[model samples]
Structures are given as C-alpha cells and as structure tokens.
Target: MAYRPAGLRTMDEAQDMPPQSPAPAGIGVRGWLRWAWRQLTSMRVALLLLMLLALAALPGAFIPQIPQDPAGVATLRADRPQLATWLERAGLLDIYAAPWFAAIYLLLFISLIGCILPRTKAHITALRAAPSRVPRRLTRFPVRDTHTTTATTEEVTRAVRRALGRRFRVAVTPEGISAERGYLRESGNIVFHLALVGVLVALGAAQMIAYRGQAVVVEGRTFANSLVDYDTFTPGSMVTGDDLDPFTFTLTELTSRFTVDAQARDFAARVVVTEPDGRRYEDTIRVNYPITAAGANIYLAGNGFAPHLTVRDAQGQVAFSQPVPFLPEDDFYTSRGVVKVPDVSPGLDQLGFTGYLLPTALAEEDGLRSVHPQPNAPLIVLDVYTGDLGLDQGIPQNVYQLDTDNMTQVMDGAEEVKVLLAPGEEVELPDGLGTISFESLPRFAAIDLRYDPTLPLLLISALAAMAGLSASLFAPRRRLWVKTTQDEAGHTLIEAAALARGDDPGLQRELERVMTAVRATTPTTPEDT
Candidate 1:
C-alpha cells in the first residue's frame, strides 16, 4: 500500500467541512529576518561579540594613545604629521573615546545582558525542577562496564546510592541507579558573565564622572585650583569647574643627585610638601616615586636653574629684581632665555634682552660652552634690543621666549650690548633703555603635579575586568550522568556519560573523575583457577 501525506489525508477527511489552503512552502523575507534576529540575540552571538571586543581593545593597548598624553601626541604629530593625521581621522588617536570602539563595547554588553538574563531565569527554573529520568538504552552511553556481584541487586543498588550521595546527584530506580554531578559548572559560568558586566559598568561609570588635571610646579611655588594655576586639565563629561578640590600646596624644598663619577646611571629628586592645613611632609619623589596627597600626585619630572636678574634705570634707581627661569640648551648645562622689563619705571620703557648662562663657561670655536652642570665657571652673554615690547596686546605670551615683532634694535646700542658677564657684573644702558645685571643663581627642580579623582576607580575596574576575562574564558557548564543496570547472568552494568555546553579543561577533569568513581564501584572476578 502506498503512503499518503498526513496533512493531505487530514484535509481529505475534513473535505465535507471546508478545504483549507496549503501553508507556504518556504518562509518569506519577514520570517527570515525574524530568524536572523533570534540568532543574533543567542548565546553564540554573545560569545562572538566578546571575542570581537577583546580583539578591538588590542590595538589601543599596543599603540600610543593621544587621550593618555596630549604632549606625547603632539611630539608624534610633529615627527610624522601625515601618519598622525590619518590616525586621528581613523579614530586611532583616541581609540577609547572613538564612536566605533564605543559601539563595539556597547553592543557586546547588550549581547551579554540578553544572554545572561534569560539563562539565569532558565537556570532558576531548572534548579526548582526535579532531576530528569534516566534514558532507557544504558548500553548506548559513551562508557559502560560489567561486573559479577555476589550481593543482591537491591544491596548493590543501595551501596551505589550511598557512594553517589556522597559526591553526586542521585536518582534511584527499581531496575538500577542513576547519578549526576558537576552542576556547579553552570553556576560558575553565570558568575563569570555577571562579573564581566559588573566590570564594564564600573569602568563606564568612572569614565563618565571623573575629573583629571595636571600642573607644572617649579620648586618653591604654591598653586591653587584656579584656571591660571593648572598647566593642563582634563575633566569628564559630568565634571565641572566647581568639582575641583580647594586644597593648595607648596613645594618648599627640592633636592636632586646625579652620578657625576659614574656614567649617570642613577638620578633622584626629593621634595618637601607643605599642605594647606599647615602640615609639612617630606617625600622622596623620583622618576618612579610619585607623591600623592590631597587628590593629587606630584612627580619630579625635571630640574633646571633660575638665575636672579636685576634691572636698574639710567637714574640709578632699582627697577626690577626676580629669578627668571632658563631652559638648558645642551646636556653640558649651557642655558639660554630672555628677560622682559615690562615694569620699568622710566615712562613705560620696554627692554628686550637675550642671555646665555654657563656653569663652567669655556670659549670654543663654536662659541661659549659649559663643561659641567654646576656653575663652576659662571658666565652670562647678553644681547639687548630696545624698543616697544608690545606688552599692551591682549594676547598671552610665553615668558621664556621674546616676541620682537614690534621691537627695534637701538643705533650702536646693539654693538655696545654686553655679550658676556661674570658674577656681580653689570652692563650699563645707553639711550635710557636699562642696565641689565646678573646676580646669584638658585637651583630649581621642575615638578609635574596631577589630580584625578577617578584614577583609583579606573585601576580597580581594569583589574576586575582582567579577572572577569579569566573567569569567563576558563569556566564551563558541564554535567555528568551515571546509569547502572542488571543483566540475566546477575552481572551489574554501569554507564557513565558527560555533556558539556562549553570548552574548559576543568570540565574534562570533572568527567574523568565521574568515570573513575563509577569504575571503582564495579565488582571484579577472579581468573579461572
């Protein structure tokens, strides 16, 4: 007899009622779209997203980042403008803050949430339900063993039950025994996923609500939380100017030592800090040791000399006196800078001057050079330009560099300008410009100070993220089931099988343990003697 389709037969039997149209053979576009959505929201999709997220973060870790340090970025841009511009346009300059990077992480987090929430609900339901019944075909299981036992089947079943109860999940039956274990694998998997979500939330919260600021401190200077005080400030989106800490500190003393006899192997700086509360503390701040207090960190980044300069008008009245910071031009300690007398009293006169200070000044074919860092051969060369200094302009200017755009050199006065000066020496001014004087010098160490309210949170979140990654990658959900049965010859048969939803070494070890336990319970027969 030929077989007929079940649907066609049902339709023929119900022909007296009403013939129904056949359902479509294949799902249309809408159905396929729905199916695709379901797949994308599945656990497999979540796993793929996690892998992509890890891969996306690799470039940021390996490459230099602009958001971490803008000065370093500037240096790179100056060295390679074309490559830097392409990187900036491609969002590699600030990878963490890029839109594509943000999208990757956000989608990954959403995928995790989708996977974990439903899985948690399913796990809870399964936990409340009773253990499933043992399948009928014990021989079809992956592992099977046979033994002849003198004890009755009931007694053997009881002994097996007692042994399994100690370490496994047991389901007793009249014919045989069934046991399972390793349910904690699923529990650990859930924990690892939840921990990853926690880490992401913590890091996102810190990045969105934290504030960071940096300031350069010369030795013996105190600064407050003002706009003029900070050399660089990076505030989070939720942070405002008022969120800055009101504390102030002064670098009272700074000490530095270099390896003069050796090949400059060791260098260190010690700084004394005086807080706003009048408490004084000393900290040895070196290249590696950063001082932390009042939500700020102080690092001894560099050191230089601030020479004391004095200026007097033609009438022999003291005009200006202060220590001007100079930058080192060479490793041998030849420093060069300019001084502007904007506060001269002689009818608002302005003077432009350039000077080079040497610790151990020596004349060579290539002009003056300093032999050592210390001021052993103190010498100063000055070049004076007398004209309008353009101080009245409403634009900010660097004190270290002079802007002679609006200035002119006085007639013959440029020739008379002193190019070299020793200690306690003075260069008299003609045409009523001013008399430039070189006084004593004081050693000043350059300190870089910073305050980031969220640095601690960032560090904690990074560590937690690493831990979550390890847990998620190493933990697996697995289950082991052991079923035993009896044959006609009174031989007891044991079968052990395992199911793993993830790949992990621990799960494999657990399966091995279950097999070992089942083998231990099997009875052994003696050889034919």
Candidate 2:
C-alpha cells in the first residue's frame, strides 16, 4: 500500500489490476538469428568492438613481432624459450594478422556501416520536409516568453516570418510560424561515421598490396632490392620475388656523433643510389630523413661497428677472414660477438672465438669496459674454443652466436688465453693452431625499405574524419516557434519558444533576442500595421 498525493490513486484501485502474464513461447530459429543480428548492429556493440580492437593491438607494441622483426623474435625465443613459444602459439607475436584481432575490427567495421545507413536515410528525409508545427502550449517549453503589443496579429506574424527567415528554415503554418536550423549537424555526424568505415577499408586493402624488408650493409658494401639480399623480408600475399624494385644502393661511409654521456646525438649514412636506368647519385641519410626511390622508402634504423679479422691455420694458409658486425650492448657501444672459422686445415679442429669489443676500452674493476662510443681506442677480448662446430648437420644457426654444446675449450695449459688485439695488431694461438689479426674498423647501417600504395588514401580518409568531427562539434541543432494570438483587450500577444536537439545553453539568449526584435519592430497601431 503506497501513500498518495492529492490526485493520486488509492491502494484498493492499484490492487484491482489483473496479474501480469508470461510471454508466449516459440519465437523460432529465424527470430533468434534476427535478434542476434540486431544486437550485433547496435551502437553499444560497435563501441565495445572498437575497444576490443584497441586492446588487441596493445601487445604489438611490446612484443617482437615476426613480420616486422623476425631476427628480434628469434633472439627472444633463444633468450626466453618457453615464454616465446607460448606467445607465438597464441599469435601474440603476430597481432595484426591474428584471427581474433581481425574478427574484432571486422565486426566493428560492419557495425559502423549498419549504424550509419539508417541515420543517413533519416537525415535525407528530414532535409526534404518542412519545419515542425508550433506547440499547443508554447509557455510549457524550456525557453519561452510572451510579449503583449499594440500591433495587430497580421503585422506581428509577417514580421516574425521575415526576420527568422534570414537565418533559419522559416515556415508560416496555419497554426503559427515555425523555423528550424542546423541540419548540417546531423549530416556531419553521418559523414564522420562513414569516414571511419573508409579508413578501415583502406587499411585492410593496403595490407594485401604492401611489402617491407630490412637489410644490414657494412661500409663499402652494396645492397640490392632483391629477396636474397635482405637480412629479413616480409611481403604481402600478392607480392612475388620478381616484383622487387631493381634499384640498388651502396653504403660508402657512416658517421656518428655522441655526447659526453655516451648518448647518440647524430647518425648519418652516406650512400650512392643507383636507379634501374644506371643513373647514380650520392646522398647522405639522417635519422629523420629517409630516401624514397622506386616507390619505396629506405630508412636508417641503426649503426654498429664491424671489425675486419684474418684467421690462418697451422700451414699459414688463410682460412676464414671477413668483417663481422658486432651487436651493441649499451649506450657506450660495448659490443659482443662470436667468430667461427669452420674451415680450418683437414684433420684439425674447427676454430671458434666469442668475445667483447669495446670502442673506447677502459679498464674496469671486473674487467674491460667501454667509456665512450667513439673509436678513440678499440680493443677485442676473446676466449678460444675448438672441436665440432656442428655446421654440416643442416641446422640453421644465428651468425652472431656459436653453438658450443659439443665443443671443447682450448687453453694455454690449464688456463684459457685472454686473446686481446687492437687495430693493425696480430696474435698467435696457444697450440700453434693458427694466427688471428685485427684489421681495419668499419661501420654497418641497418636500412628498411617499405612500399604501400594506400598511404595517400589513408591520409585523406583520416583528414576527412577530422573535418567531419569539427563540423559536428561546432554546428548546433535548434527549433524555434513564434506564436501570435489576440489578448483580452483585443491587442496582439506574441509568444516565442525554443527547443534544442541536445544540451544548448544559448537557447535562452536566442529566445530573448527574437522576443526583443518582435517587440521593437512590430507595428504599434493597427493603422501603422
């Protein structure tokens, strides 16, 4: 039993109603599917799907993805085998190409399209229609005012119609004068949603025709735009080996400058670019600037040190000698690398050396460390290993690592020899096995070439979306009405009201302005009217 107001019903009357009944069964399979479709196309579902898509892409930023950095992914697997295996199996390492991520964004795209088409149709119909009818009770509106004037009803009505017609969609109905404005607000909302759909479509299409790859080139070495020349390559489904660009570039020199704290301040790579027509041009590549040629971009990603070494066997015959690029370990460029001279003399053991190369060698408490990134004084400290290198077993091995699982440590008696060498210096092995020489020092450049035809379309669609958002945010929708009637003294009484489609604080000021104009401009006397 509920308490009642003056005009409310009693408890007995409320209890007199019949009891509610349950809904009938048998909505059918078709009806259930229809319900599911409606839910999928709803705005709430669309927003949820958009959020899910963003969440799915978060892992890509932290994880080493296979498509972008296969070498990094391989290194991750070697460093943390179990974690990398689980992430790879779950497709976290390839988030964009994952099925679940694709499902979320594809559903979001469909949902936006479904939500936009109906709103577009409604807006088009509203544009073709006339202004709404004047309300029966104008004073009941949120913003309404009444003004009694000596002017006649005809003069007041004519003046209201002419004045509002200047800025709004004016209409003079038999009931009263009605005007509405800001139809572009709804159109902007529709355009914004449609542009989102365009962006999604453009990105999806771009993935099918895009191709990107990375390569590492030592100074004085040239890299060609071919699949065999790249250290890592990721291409679209439609891209073939023969479709690679015929352009080539040679890394002639690389220069890097650093601050006192060992932080890199500048990196530049000088190269001679050759076109397919045999025309060559020399240029320098900076960190912010990338070279664009043959419909692709070449970016300078990293710079590292490569040391030239000469290895010889017992017969003094040269066995393995080349410039090996060392991976940087810290800001000061303390590098670590492994050298494998597999082809020693026959009936002899394979040679392997793993060590650290310091650019500016400084003696630390524990061992040698790097104090700066510059090549003021370079040093290489290594530990020699011999025996089986497992090269002929057909197992792929990283060039920067030597598998010492089946190898034996070579030593001078019981202690391993600390083989250290500077530029132009040479050292002989402990067992008279061979000699190693430290030759010239060169820098390597890491370059990435990427080609995507849909970049321009993506940029245009993104700009369009922003433009639509600006239009929607600034344009406000409003409805105004001017009602005129005769008062008890036979004088004309003019009333105006305003209602906005959404929250608009300016409606009150607008209503007051219209009322003031009607009062001042209306004919005072009937003859003057």
Candidate 3:
C-alpha cells in the first residue's frame, strides 16, 4: 500500500467488515399509527383485551352495587368513610357503567372485529379459489408412491380428476391432477369468530332494553307496574316511563316452613295478577322459581316481617296506621323499624318511634333475644321521641331510620323508657303523648323484576359458538396430487403424493385410501409407501 495512514484500514481489512448503509430512518407518526393498528388487531391483543374485560367484572362480583342497594351504599359510606370514598372515586360501586370498564368493553369488541374480518375474507376467497397447482417434484411430498399402469397419460389424468372431483376441489393439467379437501376447517374457524361477535352484540342489545328492580310486597297489597311501585329500580339508559307494561299483581299470602336448625326450608307466595287486557290469573312465586307475565319475570328473593301498627294521639284521633316492614337482623327474624308521626298535635311536638320486633320473645333474663322465626308469639318494643321533626324543610329520610337531630328522647332521665306489647295489645304512653298498638305480624316478600328481549338470541349465539369451536378443533385440511407419465417401455407410470395443511397424522392414511380407491377403478398396481 502506497503511503496508507496508520489509523486507516487496508482494503483486505475493509472487505472483512460488514457493509454499513445509511442509518435506518425512524418511523414517522403515520407509520407508528399503522404499527399500533396492527398490534391492536392481532389475536394476541384481542385475547389480552378479553382477559382485561374479565378482570374488570371482578369488582362488580365483590362490591355491593349502588343500583341494587342504594341504602346499603349509604350505610357503607357511614360505616367506613375512607374506604367508601376510595371505592366511590374508583367507580367500583358502579362497575358496569364505569368509564374504565366501558373502555375495556369497547376495546375488546373492536379488537375481535379487527382480528376476525380479514380472516373471514381470506377464508371466503379460499373457498371460491381453485385447488392448489401441482408441484414440480411429486417425490418431495411427505407421502408419495409410484406405480406402473398400461394406460395413456390422457386417460390416467381424466380418471384421476374424475375420482377426486367427487370429494375435493380438483384441477387437471397435461402433467397431473391437483385436489384439495376439507374446506370445513376454515369454515368452522369463521363460524367460531362470527358467533362470538354475535354473542357480544346480543348481550349489548339486551342490556340496552333490560331492567331489574326490587319491590317489597306485603300481604294484601297490590303492586302495579309503575316506577313508584319499585323499592329499588335500575332501568337501562334507553328505558322510558311509557315502556312499562301496565300489569298489576297482589301478594295474597306468604307461607313458610323452616328447618329445626333455623334455616329456611321452603317458602311460597300466592299472587293474583291482572293483565292489561282485563285478564286475571293466579300464580305461585317460590324462592328459585319465577313468575312470568307480559315480558317480565318476578323473582322472590327474600322475606321478612312487617308489624301492622296503629297509633292515636291524646285526642283519640288516628295519627299513623300502616304496616311498617322491619329489616331482619338475625336468622330468628329479630328485626328493627322506624315510625314517624310528623302531623302530631301542633302545640306539643311531632312524635317518632324506633322499635324492634321479636318473632318469639324470651324472658327478661334472656336479654332481648328471639327464640323462633314464626310470629306465633310476636312482640314489639319501642323507644319514643318527640321534637320539631324537620318534615317542614323537606329533607328525605330513610323509612328505616329516625332523624333525631331536633328531637328529645322520651326517657326517665337516666334510663330509657320502653313500651313492650304482644300481638293485638296496646300500651298507653307515660305522658299525654299517644297510644301504640301492635295489631298483627304480616310477612312481606322482597320480589325482583327482570326483563330482557334478547336473552333467547344470546342463548342461540352461545350454542353456535360451542358448535363452531367443536368443528374447528376436529376438522383438518389436506391436499393430494396425482401425475401420469409414460415410461421407456410405453407403459403408463402413475405417481401419487399427499401434503397436509399442518402436521396431520392422518395424511398417509388418507393418501392410501384415495390410491386404493383409484386403483380399484383402474384394476392396476397402486403401491403405497
């Protein structure tokens, strides 16, 4: 080398180095967006999104939903303020409608469509297209065989095509016959994806028109199909006031028989329903069974006691009279309730009472315990109060609670004075306040109403998904080629080969079957290797 610099590499050294082209350009915004689209549409991403959707539903399973239990949400907030604050902030109480949950739902939907559309189109194209062209070397196939035949090339080609045409997509040429079978493998895949998408769409449509609610129906009370009749109603966003079907039903009676261990063994409610068309019918609503009427199903969820009470002021005027349903606190049906008489004598004060009902009261030494669930020996105990009663300001109060903010407890200074009365008994207050009576113990049923128009469609789609999955898993795709050529002795040389779409274990067997069938028609040698 003539005067090469010390730091410079010689030609041989340069030749040994790998070629260095211009630095690869970074992808632009549009290119990056295309890359992201590909990633989002991939089956792996769709599977991940499905898993995320499942995880998003977990909170709904664990948390007490606000729509179903509005009062319970309030109770939780009061019980654990900080945890309630965090849960509310995260929308865990309303998991289904939360923005994050909807986002996952929508993403999974889009990913499934993106992952399925192109594959469906490709399958359709393949179905319409001709069988694959014959390869150059027949011996290259996984299963191949050659046999001698005393027949012309044209005759052999025509015979082979005719044989395979019955069961496969067959194509014939001067040199060979090419055929493909089992198009159902791809068809099943398409059906599986399409069915899954249909299931999702059907569920979404059902959710839009469905409504579920809870109603407390006491014995001898008629409940009409009205928004006001429901104790807690959660209607779909698309529901309107006019959508109600306008049917009515009365809870005639509720009967129950409990086990010796205090667990409920059997409960039944007799109901009489009136349809919109002036038709009447009798139905029984049980714990697991539902009563269906006018596209709505009524489920008997729970049962409790409602103490029928009557109260009179000092002037003997009826102040309050109704069945106040008490919430059960234990298995023995020991329950609590509230009563507020806001329209009492204007000069003195309004009266409020907080009380508990025992199904079968124990002796004083037993300390406020209930011995049974039946109301044969029912007792009501109440602590009275009197005050300004805040009804004028119109703040909503829970029917199960008393607002004691502007009230004075009617007590004996240090000990709270309580009135205990058995069924059909009355007690006169200590002062010129009122007279309280426990009239009867009538039971109430917590009934839930649900309606969905697309439930049948969802069921069909789910079945279709299962069927398609079975077909896709069990079907296989395969191709076969047969060639006919002349040997030096002027005799026909028959060659047959087979290839599987994947690693099919039955490819050689299928090849043997076809070869034997074709040879049976020809009455010639058909050797299988």
Top candidate on lDDT is 2
Cα lDDT of candidate 3 equals 0.83
Better of 1 and 2 by lDDT: 2
lDDT of 3 by residue, 1-529 (tens): 5896688997899999998999988998999999998999999998899899888888777777776667678768867989999999999988877889878888888888998999988888988888888888988776987777666777666666666667688878765888998888778777888888888888677656888888899999999989999877887757876898999999999999987667888899999999888899999999889999888999999889998888888777788899989989999999999888876655767889998999888867657778888875788889999887777764444778898999999987788989898888999976878798988889999899988887788888888888888878888788998887776777777789998877899888877776665565455644322
* TM-score, prediction 1: 0.64
What C-alpha lDDT, on a 0 to 100 scale, does residue 351 get in candidate 1? 74
Q: Write the per-residue lDDT of candidate 1 for residues 289-399, one digit (tens) a residue.
A: 787766677666666677778988666667778777777877766788788877666565577777788877888999777887766778887777766776675444556
Error of 2 at 218 (Å): 1.5
Candidate 3: 10-residue stretch with minimal lDDT: 520-529
In model 1, which regions exceed 4 Å deviation?
1-210, 236-244, 261-284, 313-320, 327-338, 345-349, 352-363, 369-391, 399-401, 407-425, 428-432, 502-523, 526-529
Q: In order, how many clashes per candidate? A: 1, 0, 0
Root-mean-square deviation of Cα positions for candidate 3 versus the true structure, in angstroms: 6.4
Model 3 TM-score, 2 decimals:
0.71
* Error of model 3, residue 175, in angstroms: 7.0
